[model samples]
Target chain A: MTGGLVYLLYVLFAVGGIALYLAMPRTQGAHAKAGLVIGGGAVAGLLALCAQVYMAPHGSNIFYYIFAGVALLAAGRVVTHPNPTYSAVYFALVVLSVAVLLVMQRAEFLAVALVIIYAGAILVTYAFVIMLAQQSGGGSSADQRAREPMLAIIASFVVMGTIAGRVSDLRELPNSPVEVQATADVMDVPLADTPVKDAGNTLSVGRTMFNQYVVVVQLAGLLLLVAMVGAIAVSRKRIPADEHGPPPPPPGEIGRTVPPF
Target chain B: MLLAFTQLGFSSILALVILGIILGMVAYSIYFERKIAGWVQDRYGPNRVGLPTLVGDLLPEKYGKFHFWGLGQPIADGLKFFLKEDIIPSHVDKPLFLIAPCVSLIVALIGFVVIPWGGQVAIFGQVFNVQVANPDIGLLYILGVGSMGVYGVVLGGWASNNKYSVYGAVRATAQMLSYEIPMGVAIMCVVLTCGQVRLEEIMASQVAGWNVWNLFYHPVAFIILWITMFAETNRTPFDLAECEQELVGGFHTEYSAMKFAMFFLAEYAHMITGCAFLAVLFCGGWDPIPFVRIPLFRPEDTGIIAMLAKMAVLFGKVAFFMFMYMWVRWTVPRFRFDQLMRVAWKGLIPASLGVLAVAIAGLYLGLHRTLWFTLPGNVAVVLVSLWVMSRAKDPVSGREANLPPLTRSPELGVQA
Candidate 1:
């Protein structure tokens, strides 16, 4: 019943989830059903986000909640799902939606940068893992790194859960952020129409963040530069087990094992 | 939650309404892109679609050449995407793939929040502001959201479980990221020079004057930003993702029907935002010219003509950039993968830092305030940038294919 488009998004996906659930075969297929569960759960999660977003007033930071929440769900799927490829992709999406959330919060510049960096470079690194890092044994159709991701998800959930109470608690949209943040909850009393006294100080602090705090920004830049270079350097060509299929031909034993036309 | 409608006064509500109107305008933007593209490619475009001929009426003439081609096309296209089946590949990491496009489109929509679209306006009785959010961190918002196109492509590609799609996603993500550094630096120069981050304030600060058209101020930075824009938008030459000759369908290959359309729609939406931001930063943003200095036509007045005029000029500038995108796409060829990286990291990064260094040096030396031989020192910085570009090595080259297959990209047989 809200204006944030909750019903349109919720109802649309609710129908899709139900349809997908019903479409599942009676035979309990691990991968397929795992897929349906992960997918249906995500749709449900998205619906929740849409509902929240729809219910939100303009300028509300509820969009951040929606973004971070859905991102958690996305990252969750990559861990729970059976396929490594799907996991990689879903994991990438988790970072991307943050960019979206940032943009919606009027951080388009950072949003774009996040997209290029996390979604672009980081995802490529993941892609390389899938391509080059096959195990000694022939990896199955299902992702063999299932345990690693499962542990990661659990570890991540624990980390997030500790912060969840405060994080999920809606961050307020303060008009004058600097002064407002300092006074917002310290006294447990809201300021109604009382304009903060030191507007100039807030501007000065903000300017300092860009200028005097330039070193941290420079460090951030360096870290990203390192990431770019590191990704490229690490992704060098190595002898792939998949390229030369299974049975151990001795190193000197070449001819028959090679791709013979 | 619907408190926005109930609790908030008219201005915020008016902002919401304007947001909706702009979105609707963006929906019709497809018609704009296609119409422009058609013109650029020497075609008639959607002229056959009649001008709303009683508001989106078609289906009476399916096969006819002018079956409401001009007016009804965007409508028809909009309907087609909505009505089409939403396909979800079984192999995809189902949840993320489903969410990526929406996330992308939403982020794309969000950038307009900080943009002072119609400058400002007044409603029935009380004054209503046009922009949705005028945060202290307004310009940063552009950098934040404008870059989220990577997610849409990456997720779509990664989730699809197709090799080509994944490859495309990776390439797109990498290209976007690589270009963003210089792009960020270039815009920083613009914002830093202006001395305000808030959109409204930035526009107001330019009352004295705009910053050198910026393209002229830092030519190398300007050129780098332009190239980054092209790469950022996944336009041709930088359109390595969807390169049919290489990676088929790029990130959206596995997506079909409405889901596929979401990716398609998101790309264009993001493209428009790219153009909008470009216009906002360099081409005087909402300031048509610095010294309009009219007393009656004040900064945030509600005169219909002035608002319309400002909107028209801003809209015109964005459209010109869009046209340039199409023109460049048609004129240029795609860059090779290494070539693309070489340009962004090797060329743009060093050059951008050089520009930033000059700016910082100028500030410390107090050269910025000083006008040399009647020209501002910043103007001199701009001229020097042009000279450096003239001397810089041109990216693509003179001769071809003399190298042995052992050298660069042994996969493609180039000199390593």
Candidate 2:
């Protein structure tokens, strides 16, 4: 009976948060809009807290809870923020929070890699794109109004609900753990020979990748090369003179384009 | 909770002390730079600005008149920055503009965490490593944190709402991204030779004999890394981001007062960190000169005095490199944008790659960590790569074919 009550409360917060997000006023004052988003974010955060409490009673580290809460809030801001640049910046916060979680899990190499690749490279590129595209301030109508917000929220929430239910169900299975452990062992056979002890964290990861998963690593490199070539081909611009003979300029225009210092 | 409090308190105190030292170093670095520039240009720099009247009055009359060769200039400059009004331009993005300098300062300051300053010291009754944190992935941490420093420049430029600032930001991002590849490759060579990623271990590995420094074996990699350091720090000859004549103040065009001061401080902080990294990787770090063999200053020595001596050795190397940075800044002309990109993509990248291949082959043939084997191999790689590069047609020149050729005569052209 108590489990049913908690489940109902979880659904209530999730649905209410999504409803508030979808109902944000497009034409309202900026302050009012910001207040609405903040209220909605609080509701979503509460929902995450409930899920965390339900999922792992043993995992009660305060730092973990704080990081998880911040990650969820930043992810929420990434999607719902009106300004595109702010959204990209918020996405960086999400990346940082995820990195902290990775650090908590003792995956130091993966955490640093996440920061370097995603926060360092990808997000910088995203900021550049945002700056290049948005010359004016972010007061565009597209930014102001969310297209099909209700549909997006409902569909995403439904998927989240399904995942949450499946996770809870898996926690109740007794024999499922043994079966999962067996599968994990089978998967670990290739990496079993790699020496991890006495090696630094990064060295171990490098050995595992090179020794056990060399083929997959090579494939990933090949995929990156192909993508780079494709990008160059698609973006290359040809000179107009190559297609058509150079047109003669007017008689007096020979030095018109040159600027005088 | 008590355990957490104790850990946090200790770390926080250590962090604050380090921060104070770095800030002081940055302040004096600006003074040193100016003095060096003045010496180069045949003029006195900041000789007039010493302590104020109040402080001078407390000193002896003779000392008061001396002015200490302008030692008080940084303090005065700091005061000026604080007293001036911070103007957030009406047209700029307020939040991003405010956050940019903080990001720059934070990222630059944090890159020093993995740098083994004094190795280990005996304090009170216990021994402790001098570094703030010695993570297993120390090298990668430095690279990762250093890379994030570009975001501060980019955000500052974009938020300024100016054409020149945006252009500067774009150039900075491109230059940083391009140079990082060669830098990473050069660092990989160091890592492979040392068989370790920890900075202190790398330092220890190089202390075997005189001329055993990584510099002796990997001269080409050292040269590449040195050039990339100048570029990464945005020093003169590579400071496209803040090219005064072209981009006005560059990314900090609209920044003023203390906010602008943060960016300036961050630049010097980055130079210090970069030089420290070079010292650790190439020079023997805190190890005494190999041939000199001063017993008190040896790498194996421990205790307070030895730690201080080692730190002094490292600092002297860093200061020498810093002077070299200033010397090059005054000597070399800035590279054009196309020339800068070509140097990285066409020149350094291929050279570093060749060095890597040679290093790998040396390791494979059971000559691992032998300077004698790798030194000649690296020299050969450098020469061969340069020869190959010379044979290739210049891409920049090839692009000029699309433009119309210049002509001086019409009807009576000499060539026609």
Candidate 3:
């Protein structure tokens, strides 16, 4: 019956959150509204998932906390109200909720990352834009661009769909029966012999990541670094004049550069 | 073969349904945020869709009749994005730009695979893990997968081929990476306390009493967590990416049609994911089920009913935080860029370090293993954080500063 009560509450909050989103302001279209609904609803759903642990901690339901917590706090401003400022606060709450939940899960690293990466970094940027948005400048004025290309966009979406579909379909690789065996191996080892259990019971990817999975973690880091470097290199450019870009430097400045001619 | 192909046997199906439901909720979140903004700001929101179009007589007298904004507004909005002009400006870096939002969206969607939504469900005389993919590495995997999203933002901003986008990109990366330090510190406190990283075990350990509410145990850490989470999600005063006053859509300015929609969609996904994370970490995931005495409904049953109940609790918590996001956005103004940076560097980082320090102290003192201590410290931190929020300056322009001229345009300077 408690489960039913829980669902009842979930329904109420989900509706309330959606109602809140629906009650916001927008001039351009429904995307904002829909986005808020989807975002707010997901957060509401994730929160409900966490409430279960609070209702009964001893009941074997803790495992769900980690993932639920990770997802819960993801919503920043899509719920609550439409104002970007409101969204930012909601976003912060999402981060806080995730952080607290992760702490509870003992996934210290992940919890911190949620706060650091999502709350700290992402939300900060969001607040910057929302605050900086011009009160009068036309953000949606470009809707009138004529004869817009369609095929390429469709193709891009298709590619995304296919790749996503493939990733989703990868269940065929079949998780190694060994994953379970590994769990058993850890369980069977003498308490004294088991390094992880003795080390605060924190069986982190960090630990094994440093031990067995060190190479994997290092490789992923390397890839991210490479991407960052490439992004910096590619994004840098001198603005051009009359070439349909940000206005360029004044005429006399170009020739002052090392007298190449 | 199909049964065997599942990620976690019978639970995979359940996981998908739950995830789908969550995604649907995310869509609605966008709708409501707008509606509430209209009402709070004293404007009618999307009641246009709920209007009776057939008679056309109910149209607002402004349009010559009383009308309800269509209830179908959100749906129409979604369809419009899909069918709208899809354009990628010629100057953009095509590959990464195209890939960015999708990557972010997929990553956000995938984070759900490991969450213990229903805990465990018994099937075919065997109890199966009620998660999509409960890898032994688990919690770490979430960190690994979750952070992949930042790349999407960075890449999207950079690829848009606009100075504003690039600026937003740089700020985003800096903001995200800088705050990561304190976030990491705060997390260490939790780890020190729990002594375990496995999601299941962590939850199991909390069975004694909702983890004694982590805030009370590690008050300093809680403060750090709240601050860092704000920076991480890029909401509010921090939302510099699309600052129309300056950046003109920031990273997504050039995007048109469904592509733009994808960016927004991924954002909502990120928000939901963040909220769930908070619910699980602080509030106690799925343990809010009220007292139950029925023989089959024992806390030990770990049955479908239990799973549903747990989902309900977690979901509610997640929604509350989501709602809080909107409430806050309206209530608080943006922080000036420098102020935002200071919070990361001077404010949150140090506070997080303090949390780390106390965590280590308590660790050596065996606080997690023992507990009921540090209550006073937590109260102090909470008071301090509340005080800080109250005193923190708005981002558009700090409370202490003269509003800068609009045209000098430092890009971030808020014109008075």
Best by DockQ: 2
lDDT of 3 by residue, B1-416 (tens): 34564435465577668678777777778777787778778987776665335455745567664334555666778888988878878887687688778866786777776666545665555676666665554565555555555656766776675778877776776677776678767766766777655666555555444335454567677666656666666777677656667788777778888888877877777777767765555555666642223343233676666667767777887788788777666667877577678778767776676666666766787765444556655555567767877797654423222322224333545354
Candidate 1 residues lying further than 4 Å off, grouped into runs, are A1-261, B1-29, B32-38, B51-69, B82-93, B122-128, B209-220, B290-305, B366-416
Every model's DockQ: 0.09, 0.38, 0.03
- Name the better of 1 and 2 by TM-score: 2
Q: Write one digit per residue (lDDT tens) for candidate 3, span A37-78.
A: 565555555456446434544235554554454444344233
Taken in order, the candidates have interface RMSDs of 11.9, 4.1, 15.1
DockQ preference between candidates 2 and 3, better one: 2
**Collision count of model 1:** 31
**Worst 10-residue lDDT window, candidate 3 chain B:** B397-406
Q: Which residue segments of model 2 deviate by more than 4 Å?
A: A1-13, A16-20, A23-60, A137-140, A168-197, A238-261, B1-14, B52-65, B208-211, B291-293, B395-416
Top model number, lDDT: 2
Highest-TM-score candidate? 2
Of models 1 and 3, which has the larger lDDT?
A: 1
Cα lDDT, all candidates:
0.62, 0.78, 0.60
TM-score of 1: 0.66
